[model samples]
Target chain A: MTEKKTLKRFASVFLASSLIVGALAGCSSSEEGTTTTTSGGSSSGSSDSSEVIKIGANLELSGAVASYGSSIGKGAELAVEEINAAGGIDGKQIELVKVDNKSENSEATNAAIKLATQDKVTAMIAPATSGNVIATAQIANQYKIPTVTASGTAPNVTENEDGSINDYVFRTCFIDPFQGIVAANFATELGAKNVAIYADNSSDYAKGLAASFKQQIEANGGKVVAEEAYVAKDVDFKSTLTNLKSKNPEFIFIPGYYEEVGLIVKQARELGIDVPLMGADGWDSPTLVELAGKDALNNTFITNHYSSQDPEETIQGFVKAFEGKFNESPNAFHALGYDTVYFIADAIKRAGSTDGEAIQKALAETTDLSLITGTFSVDEKHNPVKSATVLEYVDGNQKFNSKVNP
Target chain B: MEWLQQLVNGISLGSIYALIALGYTMVYGIIKLINFAHGDVFMLGAFIGFYAIARWDIGFIPALIISMLLCAIIGVIIERVAYKRLRNATRIAALITAIGVSLLIEYTVIFFRGASPEAYPEVMANKSISIFGASISSQSIMILAVTIVLMILLQFIVHKTKIGKAMRAVSHDADAARLMGINVDNTISATFAIGSALAGAAGVIFGIYYTRIDPLMGVLPGLKAFVAAVLGGIGSIPGAMVGGLVLGVVETIVSAIGYSLWRDAAAFVILILILILKPSGIFGKNAREKV
Candidate 1:
């Protein structure tokens, strides 16, 4: 009877400790949520009487694509710092409220809701990835906040599949179809008659880019020798590479992210299949070089947004400032981040008020706004009509090859 | 030539699966419990090998040794702490505990090192030697040789040694063996140590061959290895090796024939077919239960 009582007491104590832990976790997360709300509310509450404008930055600060998120966040923060240092936009200091999406689509939607309903941001800068932007764009539209994505390049990101424009969704990056056309044209320029595509079937970004490239390549009188697909998170590609090698295409296009691309390149080279590799913007991470080995990347090319090696003064200035602040050279995503913040601020300034409707109008009417990458206008679909830069890997360095204009 | 190339590819992949499957078969041979956390130990082994090479600048052989020793110790500790208490409990309870321990290790590793995949630094020069117009890398040859040597060593230990006799005796009837002056717990710990050591060696080899490692790298391969164990009658040593090789060859052939998406599905299909045709597996003897 005594032992039974002790067992019951132990069970109760265990339950109590777990409940305490659960409560503590809940409290900490709620404290973070409320801090953002209170801070945003206090700043914007005085916006009508004062010179402060609140903007929300929903980014993937820590997750699968955290490198892209953190780089883009740093770029946006740098732009904000520059704008404030120049005595603010129209004498109104821009207050940037940053929220991490944790690199998940569900978390991104939650971030949009929190920023819109609780923080009451007049406008928002969505996450860099296309999938995350699509996830949160509905929330932005529902909340009636003007939102801009710096690097969401999927075609459907700004336009619905039903041929209707998403007014609240805007991007500073070129769509995947344009990038794919650029790649096909570039492959033709290289005098490649036949090409192979090893696309990541699991990613919408990779599949869209591959489809576009294939269509354009055939239109430009080039034959797609073989097409193979692999799901995301697969490291082994020997069987697929071996099958593709039998076709013996002149160039292999892998429209996948750095993680899989790196392994694919390494395995392909190991199989003694030594043809130049090409990819889309997904191959623009530092981790690629470390994984694929510098020697393996010597004959590779990727279509990118901005090359840091650009001799243009505007690009140079941004690169220098970014390197100074981050202690590392900025990639294409960083440039998009910097350009995105300035783009949003430009709209806010042109709108002449912090009202969401006014900002949305100004964003739609943005024209020839010069920033990093190139000077272009936002079209009716809300995507930038900018040039795509083709970057070549020469002796382990990414050099600027050529720029293709839309 | 294409068939030859596919065969080489299959063998290279199959050897790694065999190395991991050996651990599962040996542990199940002794203890009735399936050690589900064994695969995570393989992942940990790879990380240990990676750190030994990247941080300490240790050579490949020394790194392999370090990973093997550490994982063996970890295997013994896991058995002592998690499995020992639940030894006499219901089979379902022990199985649940094994799964719980698997998640605990996977999440703890993820908590420390984020979920990003890391590149295994190239420690050896990768050179391929062509045989009958099929290029085979030196890495594949090394992996196959190591796997063969380890299997032979394991067979010798299990068949020839006095400890091997004690293990077999304890596996047959633990309480009876204990009554006849045998240490059942020590024999079981020795089995785990040897099995985990083989898994560690397999992990290091896999890292070298694939050139990438991540926290969750072991999940699919682990499941495949489990299937291999089951296909090879679960507790038989040679059966695990044959089953692994066959699974690897079938997967490679499927992918080579333009069914890359069905590679994983092909493994399970073979498993189901084998279970239906020969329930005792390829090398397993059909023994009637004395209930």
Candidate 2:
């Protein structure tokens, strides 16, 4: 029995040590793979002289953010389909090589490697969220590939904190500070003297918006009555909400994603804290209605890139094409995805070559290029100089409230 | 009054931990194995209830019954298939197997339903009843009531039924139970059934109260429930119940006092303190081990 126990201990220790060593080896190997392969601009993957203009789409197709990622994929697909049918980009058909990042930062890096090194695409579309886009930023620079994001609105997505811009990274939507200021201005217009800010502490997207909103709200002569935070994936908020209710603010700004935001809104209303709650583009999902009952969403507002209900001719035409293809009306994500493709295609057309360097140059020099979401020139920071629309939730549907321009 | 409101919130949440903790305590009593997969059983129960109400159009009560029954069967199957053969193995081996079973069930659910969360269909009217300056949603009241009634039923079943007698006998000594003509395997299976049935009921209440269900939702709650089991004394039922409620209230108080960030971490701290100060748990007797 003693000998058998010794054998068992030895076997278990051996197995445990092997697992630890295996994990460390795996991490180092992947790091080496990225470093070795993501090397030089001269080794930029695509040769645009072929019959196809290869465009890679690194998206979160099947994870926590699947609804946003898949919707953007559909809109991009629609734009590509129309372009292919109408004699392609300069008669060289655009072949989109789509990769699913699974809504993970690590997976986003892997997708960037697979797209930039192996797929040999001239340019690509980054993931929907800011963190995932940032994951691919360094890889984009390494490959000299110009990647445009549909809705990555964080300032760090395009420009680093040290005031150095990501030369190859671009975004179609307005930055986070713009949305925060826009929301503060809207609150001021609503005669809001005091406000509460409920932010998602885990996400840079929410934290960024919260900081800017606080600054602009105080600037607008409004006092911040309360500020609280809840991390993503938190399901209970009654205690926190009850505490906030005691502060008695007129407006509540919950800058978080739809998953937690929906529950917060529902729980807040249940506690009878009926002040008007506002958020940013993260609330632009149809599932928000299903999660937070229609009654709970009353008087809620969100600043978005575009609203399908906007009666502009450019917006209406894109909405019609989107609904006809998918059998459902498109949300702001879809519109942004569609515009991102056009934004890149316009750069490719003006550059007159599918070469990575040529397209990157054209993108940096983009001026007055118009799409369904907006018509604007790329600023020095590669952000769009354009307008944002605010929509109000009424009877479980988004009603276009007003447009704010910057 | 504000403090009272936080207490109400804590109890509703604690009842969930209590329901799940019972399964851990019962299984540990019978087999001396911490069934780590108990939390996933709760997750499965929520999904079962979700499909029954959302897809089959079943009423709330019937759907809850269906979820509980199905989860009970899943618990029994997990025991028979994964745990039965490991009964005589070393304790570490059995514990590792339990952890393996946990990951298997979580990934299997994720395989079928993608990682995106689903909102449970509204079961009850959205209404809050206020008392003594504290507002309690009807759903919270329902969760507390269901938990208490199920716990009472568990007590009665464990004390009154022949299987309950067999379970106590087996927990005392499996060899002695066999010598006394008790079917040890069947008694263990029944313990899993009853414990998992309560967890299933808790799952439905959790869905209705929180309104978001995901495949990996079971991980954190499972660890917390395990902590509750330990705090109550690993093999003591009454200890498990009291431990869960105390932990819940303490977490809520932490958040209410404006330290919401430490809410999740507070559970593990209590667990460590309990192990050092009173390893036998609150309701457990300091019985001497027979070598």
Candidate 3:
């Protein structure tokens, strides 16, 4: 009986200790929750009354798209550095609160709300995947947080059936339809008649590209001979390629990010299916050639926002600053991220305050603001009205194919 | 016609799953460990094959052999380092350690490979051909042929070899086998080495067939292969192959008939249904408690 009592006492003590530790850990976690600032200025304000400007970033910091997110973050950081250096936004340096959502939709939505309610961010910028933005837009709308997505091109992000954009949601990049049309037209102009479409069916980005390409192909009296789809994690495509072989396409149009597309191109080339592959802005990565190898990527064409080959002074200046800061040429996604910050900075300045409504209005009214992508003028749907450049992979290097001013 | 074509594709995919399941089942049969790192080893094989081809300019057959050898060696090392220490601990400890090992290997690969999907070298993947009323490529043929050959080889090794008898003895009664002067430790390591080698072969085929290799490539396929192992009766050799093939075919058919959006989630749903209906799996025998 005495031994039992002692054992019970020991059990209770252990349980109590665990409970205490757990409680302390939980409390510490809450205390250490992400630091969020308000006031469209940097946290390094010289005085308390200077009004803090909080710009929240919901990005994928880890996962397959992590490279894109990190690059975008670097670009955003660069822009903030420049803005702060140029006497700040109305004498207030912009403070960026970046939350890594890891590309999950629900996580991004929750992070958006956290930034909105807990952090009280004045505005938000998302260089997120399409699926994430689709989920986060509703939250942004609910909280009335004006958001600028750097590269989410899915039509669902900002559209209603009535042809109106969600008032609070805006994008700094061209929509998918715009990119798709440009790719299709470019393909047609190149005299490619029988084209194959390989897309990531789960992604709205890929789906939108496929649909637009098919429509444009049919319109131009060209045939979409084969359409194959894959998901994000799938590493095998033999069966899909085998099926595609029946169609005998002249060109392969793959509209997905570098991770899968590089492999697909390499695999297709290995399978003795040698045809020029075409893709969207998703192909604008140094890793593409590295992953797919120069031979496989040879003769491939893609539409992009900016080219590292751009000799224009404005573009060269941004590239120089980007390289000078980050020590690498900024890809198109990085440029969008950089341009997003500049766009937001311009909006904050035009609004004359960190008020959310004023910032949204200023963003909507943005016109003729020259960006690295091109001169930015927000369309009625809040997407950038800009031209796209065509790029070709030759000798394992991205060369400017042609410029399309649409 | 397209729907019919998709069904066939699903079955073919199922066959690949089955091949992977065999390795999972074989390892679990001997040690009752999940071998969570098996898929990554398979991925390593693919990368090894790639390196062999690109760096050494080895032909497909030679590269494949080299990949399997590397994978087998890694497997033996994993067993010696990770599994050997946990023999006296609780089963859960071993399971957790296995998970830790899996994560360690996966992250290590990711750190080195970066996050991008790499293109498989062209010599193996590019041949487009039509076979049996359906268009198939050279990659599909090679993958299918490799899986079949592995299955036959495994059957031969398991049913008709002295090592196979030793393996069976160890699985049935480890204490008795040790008492009978069997080299139990070496036998178990060999078992792991063989199973992991098979997984490596699967990985190379998958890489060539898919045409891309990425750091995160193994996670989903690994999970699905585990499910296939469980579905086919975890300890049964033939069962893993059958289970994998069935699961692959079911996923394909479901996506072809319904929407492709639910393709990934469908595998779990089927697994749940199967677990509910047949707790011991389709071919699993009641395991006698060792204690």
- Among all candidates shown, the one with the greatest lDDT: 2
lDDT of each: 0.84, 0.85, 0.77
Ranking of candidates on lDDT, top first: 2, 1, 3
Per-residue CA lDDT of model 3 for A1-406, tens digit only, reads 9999768855653453333223212322232222222223344655453555778988877664776676777788889889888888888877888887876888888889888988888889864677788778887778777898888877767886687678888887888877788888888887899888889876777888889889988898989887778887655454466466557888888999887787778666755577778999877777678667788788899988889788788899999999998898888888989999999999989999887888889999999999888886887878778988899899898898888877
> Which residue pairs clash in candidate 1?
none
Docking class of 1: acceptable
Model 2's DockQ score: 0.23
| lDDT-better candidate, 1 vs 3 | 1
Clashes of each: 0, 0, 19
Total clashes in model 3, counting residue pairs 3 or more apart in sequence or in different chains = 19
Error of 3 at A33 (Å): 20
Give stretches of model 3 more than 4 Å off: A1-64, A80-123, A130-146, A160-164, A348-356, B1-37, B44-165, B168-186, B201-211, B214-216, B219-291
Error of 3 at B249 (Å): 11
**lDDT of model 2, residue B67:** 85
Query: Which RMSD values do the candidates have, in order?
Result: 5.0, 7.2, 8.4
Q: List the TM-score for candidate 1's chain B.
A: 0.98
Of the candidates numbered 2 and 3, which has the greater TM-score value? 2
* lDDT tens per residue, model 2, A1-406: 9999768855654454333223222322231111111212111124554877878888878766776787788888888888878877887778777888989999999999999999888889999998999999999999999999998888899999999999899998899989999999999999999999999999888998999999999999999998988898888888888888888899999999898999999999988789999999888887798889899999999999898999999899988998898999998888888888889998999999977889988998999888888788999999989889999999999999999988
> Cα lDDT for residue A349, model 3?
94
Task: Report fnat for all candidates as fractions from 0 to 1.
Answer: 0.46, 0.35, 0.14
